[model samples]
Target: MLIIEGAGRWTTPTDGANDWVEHLRMPDLSVGTYCIPAGGLDDQSPHTEDEIYVVTAGQARIVTPDGATEVGPGSVIFVPAGEEHRFDEVTEDLALLVIFGPAYGSRAPAHPAPLRPRS
Candidate 1:
């Protein structure tokens, strides 16, 4: 069993206003806890792995190929591999629980890129 306090530790800066804490990670999958401050938008990039975001607090807008949608507490968002997506319109500092990987029945590669807002 994996356990994480994930309160003050595990924070990785997404940008100027956004930061995320890696609460859990394994060879098969990984889980992250994020905090998006007001007006935070992580760069839009293509993902090589499947990802799901569960909103824990506040609100955010997720922009994808299909379109954009508002995500808030109790809401969930999924992004398939190679999909262009981003987080925006963060209100009142958004907190999220992110999960992705082979742990979730996915066998995709990791395609990481520089964090840059989509233009």
Candidate 2:
């Protein structure tokens, strides 16, 4: 199993997925950790893959063409493929579990296999 430590302390030079450290890369999905520094610029570009952001720590206002919404720990945010989105008003470092489907440079899983049951 892959694991990352220090969600609150992880530092990045930029905002958004650029801060993300790839933990797993599969043809069906990918997972990583991203940290956006507080008071940093929000210049996130659109993505080609659909994604979900599972907030691990800190607070931020996610801005999109639609509007802005305040989010904190445990917040689940979704951004569709090719949609403009970014994080603004970051009160604290924003750490997230980013999941991207169909992996990078690969097609989606043709048939999803059943996950192994937890012991």
Candidate 3:
């Protein structure tokens, strides 16, 4: 069994380094935790793989082609493959469980994942 003690340690105090902590890695999926500082900016651009964001703490606004939505603890957000998105208006340090299907750095499929958001 894989256990990552304290996901908060995932963030790096050092600059110019990846701060995400990957708790699991597989051929078709990966799970990780990331923390953005209060008032931090998300410089990330559109990605090739669909992603699901589970907000574990803090608050922010997520913007995409579909427009923006305020998100906070317990919020779940989805972004389609190749669709532009980013975080803004952060009021607190944001902690998230980020699931990247097929994982980043691995080859991505041409289509979005077949699964839909759970009701």
Candidate 4:
């Protein structure tokens, strides 16, 4: 078993314009804590893994291929693989917990039919 205290983690710099800290990343999952300063924006990027973001504090707008959505404290957002997305216009210092990784057998089956190649 692993225990992680968010407050104890060290912040790491990412290319994105926000303060980020890698909290925990086990064999089956990865987690991070992020603080987006007011008016800050995280440059858009795509991911190979699925991800979920839980807003712990502040507010921001998430831009995705589908459209833009408002997220704030208590808001939860899921981002699918290969999605183009980013955060923008953070009203206050935004804090969030992000999780993503290979699904442990405990949760669900890991493999499904392959997706068609992107056009």
Which numbered prediction scores highest in lDDT against the true structure?
3
Task: Note each model's CA RMSD in angstroms.
Answer: 7.1, 11.1, 10.5, 8.1
The candidate that wins on TM-score is 3
The list of candidate 2 runs beyond 4 A from truth reads 1-18, 105-119
- Candidate 1 local lDDT, 1-119, one digit each (tens): 65666643324455565776666668778787777677776764665678888887877788887999988888888788778888888775777788877443345455688799979
Worst 10 residues of 2 by lDDT: 8-17
> Candidate 2: deviation at residue 54, Å?
0.6
Candidate 4: tens digits of C-alpha lDDT, residues 7-73: 3222433554677667776777878787777777786467777888888888789899899989988
Order by TM-score, highest first: 3, 2, 4, 1
Candidate number that wins on TM-score, 3 or 4: 3
- TM-scores for all candidates: the values are 0.73, 0.74, 0.77, 0.73
Across residues 10-90, which tens digit of lDDT does each residue of candidate 2 receive?
A: 566542433757777887888777787887666767777888888888899988889999999889999888789988888
Work out how many backbone clashes candidate 1 has.
1
Which lDDT values do the candidates have, in the order given? 0.72, 0.76, 0.77, 0.74
Where does the lowest 10-residue lDDT sum fall in candidate 4? Answer: 7-16
Candidate 3 — which residues are off by over 4 angstroms?
7-18, 108-119
Candidate 3 lDDT tens digits, 1-119? 76766653335434633357777778888788877777778888777777888998888999988889999988988887788998888787788888888786466446776998889
